[model samples]
Structure formats: structure tokens, C-alpha cells
Target: MKMVSYLVRHHLKMELRSLHNVMSLVIFALASTYTALQVLGGKPDPTTWNALAWIILMFTAFNSASRVLPEDLTAVRAYMHWTVPPRVMIIARTLHQSIIMIILSCLLLFALGLFLGSGNMDTLSIFGFLAGMILTAVGLASTLTLLSALSARAGAGYGLTAVLGLPLIIPIVMISTSFGTDLVTGVALGQTVQNLYYLGGLSIAIGIYGYILFPYLWRS
Candidate 1:
């Protein structure tokens, strides 16, 4: 537990110290949102708004999370292998990506609302919207972090990460979109709970798989 916390903090600090990633994220988000607005030519409907937001987020996540294990990290990884367990490394990276994605999601949502116009959201619906965003971010982080590790091992770059990650992340995107739609439409609480359960279950399963499989990749 302590090791995981330490590793997480270490990665978090590294991320904070490096402005490149954050700058890229903000630029991409803004550019994407601007393009979306130009294409729509006006405020998009709730469904279009939700879909565009997710598309932006998915690509942003791929861009950021794919770099979690850069090609140049071999030396750093070697030192980490001696000091930290594989599970710790994977979990810490995943957690760091999740935090970054969550922040990005919030910023993206604000931007979407500002330009695209957020649909009418009551307190309960707002809760659901935020919950869906967080869960989707976690699921995306877990799935992409593992895929990024695998791609890094193969000497593949961000392109390959997108290739491998997009198909796998579709279910998460679908679930999150559905959850967001429910929130916008004011679906029954029970239905919302069921969707949340699916998202949470998927996230946990992916996290467990990444934790268990990462050690083998680490050894490789």
C-alpha cells in the first residue's frame, strides 16, 4: 500500500513538472471543441453534444495515456523494477492516468457547456453526469494503460496505441454515452444505477486484469 502510494505520488509529480502533456491536452481539447462548433454551426442537441464530448475525451485520453510508458522509459523502468513491484507500477500509472483524465474530462465538459451549451441538468442529473464521466475515465485509463504497456514493448508508437485501444474502449464509450443520455433524459434512478453498475464492474475487471498481467510484461 505504501509502495503504491509512493509510486503514484512520484508519477504524479513527474506529470505536474512536465508541462508538455498538459499543454497538448488543452490545445487538443480546444481545437476539437472549436471544430465541433464550426461543424454544428449552432448548439448541438443533447445526443450530439454527448457524443462529441466523448469523442474528444476518448482521443484526448489516448493521446495522454498512450505516453504513460514512453520508449525512453527503459532506463527509468529498470531502476523502478529493482525498487517497486510490477503491480505497484501498473496501478500507480493507471491511477495517475485516471486523475489526469478526470481533470481533462472536467475541463472538456466545461468547454462543451460553454460553447456547445450543456443541456438542462438538475442536481440529480448533474450527479449522474459527473459519475458517468469519472467511471468512464477510470475504465479508459485502466484499459489504455495496459494497452500502452503492451504497445511500448512492441516498439509501437501512439498510432498503434490508438489502433489497439479504440476497439477495446468502445464498450466503455458506449456505456458512458448511454449513462450520459440517461442523465440528460432524466431516466429512472433504478436504470441509472444499473448503468453505473455495468461501468463500475467493467472498470474493476479491467484494473484487475492489468494488475495481474503487467508483471509478465514487466519481466519482458
Candidate 2:
């Protein structure tokens, strides 16, 4: 456990230090935010705007996943292999990507708040909105991290990551879109509680099991 935490910390530091990946994520997020605002126009119906936010978030997440795998050009990834257990490295990268994703989500939500109106913006509902975003971010990050580590593209890492990340994020898109719309429309918790539970459960299951298997996947 300690080792995993250590590796994750180091991975996050390296990720933060990497100008290329950080800038790419920011650019993609800005583009997505701009597109989402255009889709919203002035004041879109709450439901339509809510769905647009999820769609934009999903695409941005996909674009960020492209560069997740450590660049093989440097010996850094090679040294990590010798020092840290593969699982630790995998979890570390996953955490790094997850943080980037959550940041993007917050940016998108903030942009939406500025340009689009949320008909229902209460404390409990805002909590629910954030809850949905967390689940989506973690689930997508872990799944994409595992897929990229396993399926090494000789050169086309970006294209391959997209193919692998898309299918995994689809279910998340459904749950997030539904919950976001429900929150915007002032729907009762009872009405949308099932979607929330499903997302939370899936996120936990995937984060745990995905790491356990990724060590083997990374090996072969």
C-alpha cells in the first residue's frame, strides 16, 4: 500500500512537470468548453444543455487519454519498470489521469454555470452533480490507462487509445448524461438514484479490479 502511494505521488509529479501533456489537456478542455457554450447558445433548455455538457466532457476525456502512456523516448519509464512494481506504476498513471480529468470536469462545469443556466442549483443537487462527475472521471481514466499500457501502439498511440477509450466511456456517458439532466430539471432523488448507484458501483469495481489485472496485462 505504501509503495503504491509512493509511486502514485511520483507519477503525479512527473505528469505535472510534463508541459506537453498538461498543455494538451488544457487545450482540449478549452476547445470542448467553447463548443459546449456554442451548443448552448444563449439559454438552452436545462435538459439540452446538461446533455451537451456530458457529451463535451466525454470527448475531452478521450483526447486527454491519447498521451497518457509515458513517452518511450525517455529512459524514465524504463527506470520505473525496474524500481516500482508494474501495478504501482499502473495505479500511479491512473491516478494522474484521473486528476487531470476531474480538473477538466470542473472547468466544464464552471463554464456551463457562467454561460448556461441550471434550473435546479441546490446544495444536494450540486453534490449529486459532482458525484456523477467523479465517477465518470475515475472510471474513464483507469480503463484508458489499462488499455493503453496493454495495447502498445508501435507509433500510433493516439489513434489506438481513442479506439480503446471510447467503448469503455460509453456507459459512463449514459449514466452521467442522465444524472446531469435529472439534476438540472429538479428531478427527485428517487427518480435518478439508480443511475447514481450504478455509476458509483461500477467506478469502484473498475478501479480496483482494473489495477489488479493491469500488472499482468502490462507484462503480456
Candidate 3:
């Protein structure tokens, strides 16, 4: 628990301090916000809004996660290697990406529904959106971080990471979109519950795969 907290704090500090990461995420957020406003007009359908949000969030996560491993290079990696356990580093970095994903998801949701006139949004639906976003982002972010780090050692690192992660993110988008449908419409109680369960279950599977695979990827 102590180690996990330390890893999370350390990575969080680095994220806050890093100009590159901040700038990239800000740019991504701006783009996402703009797109969200244009697409989700007043009283947009829940299915449509959810799909849009998922795309926006996924792209933003992809852009932001593209840099985590490359950001460190030799010195930082070496320092972390000697100071912290690999598992600690992985968990901490995963948490950092998860935070970014959630923040971006919430920001986009607000800008679209509030300013752009999404009549479909209610307090509970917004909560549901947040819930769905967290599940999708956490899994996507950790998996991307692990894969990107592995690819970082290759010449086509960024390209390879893109190839690997983009396809994997599709399921996240679908699950989140389903969850959003429930939130936006608020009609089918059982359907929404089922969608949320499926999304959660998918996230768990991906998260487990990433956690199990990350250490091996880290060494390679």
C-alpha cells in the first residue's frame, strides 16, 4: 500500500511538472471539447452522445499515453529502476493515466452537455457517464502504457504502439457507448444495468491481462 501510494504520488508529480505532457493533454482536451460541442447538440440521443464521448476520450488517451514511456528516456528509467519495484512503477503510471482519462472524460462531458445544449443529460446520467469513462480509461491507459513501453525499444515504437493499442481500444468504446445509451435514454433499467456490468467485466479482463503482462513487457 505504501509503495503504491508512493508510486502514484511520484508519477502524479512528474505529470504535473512535465511541460510536454501538460501541453499535449491540453491540446487533446481542446480538440475533444470542440468536437463534442459540435456533435452533441441540444437533446442529442444518448447513443450518439456516448459514442462521441468514447471516441473523444479514446483519442485523447491515445495521444497522451503515446508519450509516457518515451518521456523518461535513460536517466529517469534508471533512477526508477533502482529506487522502486517494477510493479510499483507500473501501478503508479497506470493511476496517472487513469486520472488523465477521467479528467478529460468529465471535461468533455460538461462542455458538450452544458454549453452545447445536450438536453438528454441529467445528474444521474452524468454520473453514469463518469462511471463508464473510468472503466474504459483505466484499462486502456494501463494497457497502452505497458505496450508503448515495450514498443519504445524498437525503431517503429510509436507506430507499433499505435497499431497495437488502437484496435484494442475499440471494445472499450463499444462498452462505454452502451453504458452511455442507458444513461442518456434512462428508459430501460435492466438494459442499462446489463450494459454497465458488461463494461465493468470487460475492463476487468483487460486490466488483468495488462497487469499480468506488464512485468514481462517491462523487462523486454
TM-score for each prediction?
0.92, 0.86, 0.84
List model 1 lDDT by residue over 1-220, tens digit each: 8887887887777777887878789889988998999999999887788788788888888888766543237887777778777888888888988998898888888888788887666767766777788889899999999888888877776678889898999998998888888776667555677888899999999999999999998875
In model 2, residue pairs whose N, Cα or C atoms come closer than 3 Å (at least 3 residues apart or on different chains), thus clashing, are none
- Candidate 2 lDDT over 1-220, as tens digits, reads 7887776676678777876777777677667667666765677777777777777777777776766455343365567657777777777778877888888888777776766755456777776787788778878877877766655624455677777677877787777887888888888766787888898788778889887886675442
The 0-to-1 C-alpha lDDT of every candidate, in the order given, reads 0.82, 0.73, 0.70
Sort all candidates by TM-score, best to worst. Answer: 1, 2, 3
Candidate 3 to truth, TM:
0.84
lDDT of 3 by residue, 150-192 (tens): 7775546577888988887778777777667666776544457
Give the poorly placed runs of model 3, Cα more than 4 Å off. Answer: 35-47, 70-72, 186-190
Candidate 2 weakest lDDT stretch, 10 residues: 68-77
Cα misplacement distance, residue 15 of candidate 3 (Å): 1.9
Best by lDDT: 1
Candidate 2 segments whose C-alpha is farther than 4 A from its true place: 71-75, 153-156
- Residue 75 CA displacement from its true place in model 2, Å: 4.2
